[model samples]
Target: MNILTEILLQAERTPNAAAIVQFGRGSGCSFDEEILCSYRTLVEQAQGLCTRILRRVAADAQVGVVMGNSAEWVLADLALMLAGCTQVPVPLAFSAPQAGWLLQNCAVVLTDASGAMRLQEWLETGLDLPRNTMHVVFGHYQQQSAAAPTSRAALSGPDRIVKVVHTSGTTFRPKGVRIRRDGLDALVSALWQRASKDDYRRYLSLVPFSLLIEQVTAIYLPLTSGGALLLPPADMLPLGSPGVIAADRLEIIRAARASALTLTPALVEALAAQAIRLAGRADALHALFGRPTAPLLAAGGAPVANQTLTTLDQLGIPVYQGYGLSENSSVATWNHRGANRIGTVGQPLPHVEVRVADDGELCLRSTSLFAGYSNDDPSSCIVDDDGWLHTGDLATRDSEGFVTITGRKKTLIITANGRNVSPEWLESAYRSVPGVLHVIVYGDDRQFLGGIFVVADRSRADEIRLAIADYARRHLSEIEHIHTPLLIEHSPDVMAQLFTVTGRPRRDAIAPFLSLQKDPSVHEHP
Candidate 1:
C-alpha cells in the first residue's frame, strides 16, 4: 500500500485530532506561538498542493523538494506521495553542483521562495539545469477546502519507487539511492513496533526532513501512529552549516515537551557540552532536555562518544545508539526500551537479519533494503549473489546479538609496521574532549598516528592536546595514540570542506590542507 494511505486512514479516524504542531521562533527562553494542524487540515493542505502539482507535471515525473525543514516541507512530502510522483529530497548541505547532478532529469523542482531565490543565484553562478525543467515555488499553490481524491490506480504497482534518497559520504559525489514503497513501509512498521510506548505520543524533528531517518521517524512513524509531528520554527536557529545544531535549539524540545528524538552524533555532543555546563544536575537537565518527559533519544549518523552517552545517562536522559546506512533504509539495529545496550548499537530489529562477514564487515538482509542506486553504479553491487548487502562497516556481534561497529572497510588505517588500526575508535576518544569540534586521524602509512583537530578555541590548543593525549594513554593503544597534533580554529568555511555533510571528517581529502610537523617520536622511529 502507498504510505500516503496511512495518513488518509488516520485523517478518517481522527479528523480533528492534532497531527502536527509547529512551534514559533522567539528570542526569549520560551516560545510564543504554537500552531497545531489537525489530521483533516493536514490532508486538505496536502491534497490541494498535490492537485496543483499534478496539474503541472507529467505522471511519475521526478520532483525535487528543496526547502528548510518546516510544516510546509512535510505537507509537500505528503502531497508528492499522494500524487504518486518520485521525490528527490535536496538537503541544504548539497552544493549547487551536487544538487544539479541529482536533479538532472527532473521535470520540475519545487522549493520555498527563499530556496527559489537561492536556485536563481546558483543559475547566475553557472549551474546548468535541464532545459525542460521548471523551477516552481510552493507558496504559489493555495490550499482548497475540498480534499482532492487520491487515485489509487496511479500509486499501485509491482515496481514501487517512491523516493530517490541521496547518500552523504566521502565519495567524489553523492549517490542517489532508490527507495521503494514496500521498503519504507517495512522500516516504519518495524521502528513503530520497537518504539517506546511512553514516548510515542510525539516525534520531534531536529534534523532536516531531507534526511531519510528523519523522514521516516519524524514523518511516517508519527503519521502512522496517529501522533503529532512536532517541527521547530525556522527562525529558531539559522540553517547553512552541516552538523552545527545550536545549543539553544534543544530548548525547542523542552518547550514542546517532546518525547522522541532522532539525534545525530554531533547533536549528542552538543547536548553533552550542555550537560557538562550543568554539571549533570537533575534540575538543570530537566530544564534543558525535559528529562522525565524525554524517553526515546536515539543517536546515530556517527559514533557518539561513550563519555557523552554517560553524561546524558547521568542527567536522566535516555540515549539509545543505533547503526544503519542509506542502503539499509536508515536503521538496521537499534537499542529500544526493552533492549537497552549502552556501548553497542543494540540488536537487530525484528525485520532485519545481520551477520559479520569473514573479514568482519557487517552484512545485512532486510525487506527495507534499497532497490538499487539511481545511476546503476557498480559500487551498489555491495550486495552479493546470496542477497546479503555487504555493508562496508566492520562490526562484531556478541553472543547476545548486539552489534558493535568497529570501523569502515575503507577507513582502516594501516601503519608502516603492517598493523591495522581503526581510526574510528581513536577519533571517538579525541572527540570526547570537551572543546574538540572535530578530529581526523592521519597515519595510513606512517610509523605512528597523527591528526588535525578543529577545536572551538584554538588558543587552548595545548590544553586540548594534553586532554586528548591523556585520554589516549588511558583508552587507546600505543600505535593508536596521536603523536602529532595540528589545531585549527572552528569556522564554518574550514569545516565545510574538511567534513562530509553527515559530520564525518574527509580524511583522504584533508591531508593536503594540513601542514605536517615532524614529531620527535616519529624521528626516533625512522
Candidate 2:
C-alpha cells in the first residue's frame, strides 16, 4: 500500500480526530485545539493541493518543497504524494544559493506561505530559477493565481513518485534520492509493526517536517497509527534556535502531552538534561507540582552518548536510539523498549538486514531503499548492483545482534604512523568531561590526536581543564591522550559556514582550524 493510503485510512476511521497541529510564527493552529478539521478536511486539502500541483507539473516530475516546519509543509508534502510528484524537501537553513541550486535541480517547485516570500526575495536578487518550472505557493499566491488551474482528485498508481530526499550537504554536493511508493510503504509498515500495541494517540514533533525522517515518523507514522501529531510554535523552536537547549522542547513535549518524540542527538542531550533536572527535583517537586510523564522517546540523526542514556533512564523516560541514513527511508536499525542496549542503535528492524564488512563499514538491504539518486546517476550513492545499501557508517554488532556505530567512513582519521582512529569516539569521550560544551578531534596525518575544545562555561576553564586532564590520565591510553586542547573563548562560527544549524559540530568544516593550529611557524617562533 502507498504511504498516502495511511492518511486516507485514518480519515476513514476517525474523521473528527485531530490530524495535525501546526505551530506558526506568531502562534499556531491545531486541528483539534483552535480550528477543528476533521480528517476529511485534511484529506480534502491534500486532494485540492494535489489537483493544483499536478495541473502544473507532470506525474513523476520532481517537486521541490521549500518551507519551515508547519501544517502547510506537511499538507504540501502529502499533496505532492497524492498528485504523483516526487517531493524533494530542501533544508530551510540553506542559503539563497543552495535554495536556487535545489530549485534548478528539481523539475518544479512548491513553497508554503513563508517559503514563497523567501524565494521571491531571492528571485528579485537575480537567482536564475528555471522558466518553464512553475511555483505553487501553499497559501494565497496573489499575482500568479491565473497561471495554473486547481482541482481536487487523486492520481493513479503509475503516476506516483513518492520522494526525492536530499542528503545533508556536509562534505559533498547534496544528492536528491528518488524513492518509490513501495519503498515508503515498506518503511511505514515496518515501523508500525514494531510500534507499541498501546495507542500512540499523541505525538510532538520538533524537527522540520521537510526532513524525510520527520516526514515518515512524525507525520506519516502517527497518521497511520491513528495518532495526533503536534508541532511546536515557530518562534519557540525556530530553525535558528541553539541546538543545545532543552527547555523549549520540554515545554512542547509537556504541552502536547506527547507520548512519543523523535529527536536528533543534540536535542536528545537537551532532553536528557531536562530529564535529569526533573529527576533531581522529583521528591520536592512531586509535592509542590505534579510531575508530567511521557512514556516513549526515540532519538536519532546522530548517536546518543552513553551518559545521555543513563540520564534518561534516571528520569524515568524510556529513551531509545535508532540508526539510518536518508537513502534507507531514515531507519534501518532501532532500539526499542524490550530489546534495547545502552550504547547500540539496537538490532535492525524486521525485514532489514545489516552486516559489517571486513573493515567494519555497515551495509544493509531493506525494502525502504531508494530507487536511485535523482538525475539517475549510475554511480550509486548507496545501492550497489546487488541492491545492498552501502551505508558508510563504521559499526560493530555484538553476539546478541545489537549494532554500535563507531564512526563514519569519511570521518576515520588516519595517523601519520598508519594507525586508524575514529574521531567521533574521541569526541564522545571528550564530551564526557565536565564543562566541555563541544569537542572536535583532528589527527588526519599527524602522529597524535588533538582537538579544538569549546568550554561550556568560560569562568570554569581552569577547573575543567584540570578535571579533563585527570580524567584522561585515568581513562585513556598515552596515545589516546589528547596532545593539547586549544580552548576557544566562544563556540566556533559553525552556523556562519552552514556547518551546523543545530548544536552538532560540523567536523569537516572545523578540520581546517586543525591545520591552522598544526602550522610549524608558531612552534618555530616559540
Candidate 3:
C-alpha cells in the first residue's frame, strides 16, 4: 500500500543500491545491461519529475502514460503517485484507436521521447481526443538524478484516487479500475509478505508494467525487499505489445539470472516442455533459467494444465499458482513457497476473505478491493452491498482453503445434448501443439465446440491440424473436442489483443471470428 511512500522509505534505507536494471541499454555496463538507476537516483529522478508534473497537472487529475518498459516508465508512475495525479496507463499493445479510447478522459499525458513520437503519430491520425491535451516528457532529466532533493510534491491522500488501471473488456471501450491509496497499500504489503514469500530478489518483468499484477510483483514487491527490478530490452519485452516479436524469451530470462518471475499458462507450459526435454543434460535448468538453481516461477493469467505443473514438479522448478483480477488490485489468493497445491490457486491472502456462492461463483472481499470503476455508479459496480466482488469465475473451495477456479460462471459451453464444458482446459490442450500460439473455443448452447487457432507457422498448417487432432483425441472428452477448428495467421500483436491479461479471450473482440461457428456450411476440421 502507498507504493511511492514505501519505495521512498526503501530508498532511504538503501540509497546506493541498484533498484532498476535495463538490459541492452549499452551504457558501458555488461555490454548490454546497466544498473540504470540506484535507489537514490530513482527516488530523486521521480521527485524531479513530480515537480514537473504538478506544474501542468492539478492534484488528482487523471494523467495518461504511454511508454515501453524502461526506468523512465517506472519513474513516471512513481512521479504521478508522488504528485497525486490519477495515473492512467495505456498499454503499448493497444492500437492507436484503443489507446486513444483509454486516454480519452485524461487531459494531460506523460511520456518518454519514444512515447512522445508514438502519441504524436496517433494524434496526427486524428484520434478523438480530449481537447488541448498536454504532454510532458519524463526521463529527460536523467542528468539531474544525482542532484540533491528539491521541494517535494505531496503524497496522494489514502482515500484519494491515486491511480486508474484501464482494462479493455468485451467492448472496444476500456474500463478504468479506480484505485485508492489505502487499498493499494494493503494489497502490496500482503502480497510481498505472504504471496511472494520473500524469495524474490530479482524480479524479471516480462509483462507490461501497465498491468496491476506486474506493478505489484515487478515493482512494489522488489522495492519493498530492496531487491532489483530486471527489465527486458525492448526487443525482448514481448507480452503486451503485439508489434514486438519476442526474441528467445527463455534466453533473455536466463541471461537476467532472474530469481523470481511470473508467466502466463502458455509461457510456463512452453518452459516446462523445454525443461522436460533437456532433463538429461546437466545444464537442463541452466537452459531453462540461468544457473543450475531454479527460479521462483508463478503461473497465472490463465488456468495452467495439471500436466504442465506435473512436468515442472518433476523437473524441480519451484512454481506457485495463484489468481486475482484488477478488481482486487492484483493478487488476492496465492500459493506461497511452503503451501503450494498442484491444481489449486493457493489460499486467499491474509487480508482477503473468500466465499463461493450457491451457484459456484467464487467471490472475495478485501481492503485491496478497487474503490470502483472510474466514472461508473457505485451501485452499478461489480462489488455488491455486502462488499463481495462476485468474480464471475466459477470456483470451488477445498476444506483446507485451497481454491480451484473451474470456469466462468457465465461462460459454460452448454451443448444441445445438455453436457457442459469449460473451454479453458480444452483451449489449453489445443494450444499445446508447437505451432498453435493461442486458442479460444466457443460453442455455448450449441452441439459442439468451434475454435480459432493462432498458428506460429502457417506453412505447417497440415502438420499442426494433425497435431491438433492428435491432442484433441487424447486429452478431450468427445464433447470437448473442437468440431470446427479454424487456423488463421496474423501478427503476434493482432493475436495478443484478443486475450486479457489473465489469458482469457476477450469474446467481444473476437466476435467476428466466432461468428463463423454459426455458419452451417463450415464443417469440422478434418
Which portions of model 3 show Cα errors greater than 4 Å? 25-31, 130-139, 142-156, 195-198, 243-247, 375-381, 411-526
Estimate every model's Cα lDDT from 0 to 1: 0.71, 0.64, 0.71
Query: For model 3, what is the error of residue 455's alpha carbon versus the real structure, in angstroms, after optimal superposition?
Result: 21
How many backbone clashes can be found in candidate 1? 0
Clash pairs for candidate 1: none
Model 1 per-residue lDDT at 202 = 78
The estimated TM-scores of all candidates read: 0.75, 0.71, 0.75
What lDDT tens digits, residue by residue, belong to model 1 across residues 444-492?
5353566778899988978887888776645443445664577778998
- Candidate 2: regions farther than 4 A off: 23-36, 105-107, 130-160, 169-172, 197-199, 238-246, 280-292, 375-382, 412-526
Residue 192 shift from truth in candidate 2, angstroms: 1.1
* lDDT: worst 10-residue window of model 3: 239-248
lDDT of 3 by residue, 321-439 (tens): 88887788878899877888999999999899999999998999999888877645222237789899988888999999999988875654543222335565557767778899888
Candidate 1 whole-model C-alpha lDDT, 0 to 1: 0.71
Task: Give lDDT tens digits, candidate 2, residues 1-526.
Answer: 5566667777888888887765443345222234335576776776767766666777667778877676777777777766667777766545455566666757777776566665676677575865443454434322122222332234233434577776533322345677677777888888876786243566777666656777887778777766777766655543222232443455555446566767656556666665566565645223211235554777776566697787677666667888876688778999887887889888998879988989998999988887776544322456678778787779999998899988876765544322334565567778899888677776654435567777767778678778777866555433445635666545456334423666566766765654566433112110
